[model samples]
Target: MLQIEDVLRDRGSRYAVSGGAVQGRAGADAFVAELKRVKKFAKATHNTWACVFSDLGPVKADDGEAGAGAVILKMLEREGLYDHIVVVTRWYGGVHLGGDRFAHVVTAVRAYFAALHSAQSR
Candidate 1:
């Protein structure tokens, strides 16, 4: 798995991103489960994620923060990433960020991609 922690900080909210190769829905679920096994992620306010499978198409979860899953899904589709799931976990800081939240999610996903690419290059 590739993880980029503290990818973004806006207002009082903090975001982290993670991703890994997965097979199908079960694989995605397992990946999420593994992520939540960490105490910090398990307590996060939201853990939005998305995946595009070559065989199964796209799957996503907002985990409470609405529309975030779609944002991640679109990024995966745009990048032509298949059989891989990307997660953006947010820790709310009691401020309603409105549209800024979506932008933050995008930044987090991009950070994940950068980290993944950097890892693969090594």
Candidate 2:
């Protein structure tokens, strides 16, 4: 699995993104579990994720942050990424970020793509 940790920070909140190849819903679930195995991720306030399989279409989970999963899913779809799972983790800072939270999610996912591209280019 590939991870882009600490993608962005704002208003005391921190964001990270992680992802890798997955087969289906079960694979996506396992990928999420694997991420949470990391101590910090396990303690995060929200762990939203989304994925698309050529065979299974799209799948997502908000993990308590409403619409977060859909936001990730839409980005993945726009990127034409398939058979992969991407997670956006946020550690809340005890303040409401409102719509800015969605923008953060997009930033995290974009960071993941950038990191992924960098890794593959190595």
Which residue runs of candidate 2 sit more than 4 Å off their true CA positions? none
RMSD in Å for candidate 2, one decimal? Answer: 0.9
Q: Model 1 clash pairs?
A: none
The alpha-carbon RMSD values of the candidates against the true structure, listed in the order shown, are 0.7, 0.9
Q: Per-residue lDDT tens digits of candidate 1, residues 5-83?
A: 8897998999999999999999999999999999999999999999999999999999999999999999999998999
lDDT string for model 2 (1-122, tens) is: 88878888998999989999999888898899988999999999999999989998988899999999999999999989999899999999988999999999999999898888898899
Q: Which candidate number would show the highest TM-score if scored against the true structure?
A: 1
Q: Model 1 off-target regions past 4 Å?
A: none
Candidate 1 — worst ten consecutive residues by lDDT sum?
111-120
> lDDT score of model 2?
0.93
Q: Candidate 1: global Cα-lDDT?
A: 0.94
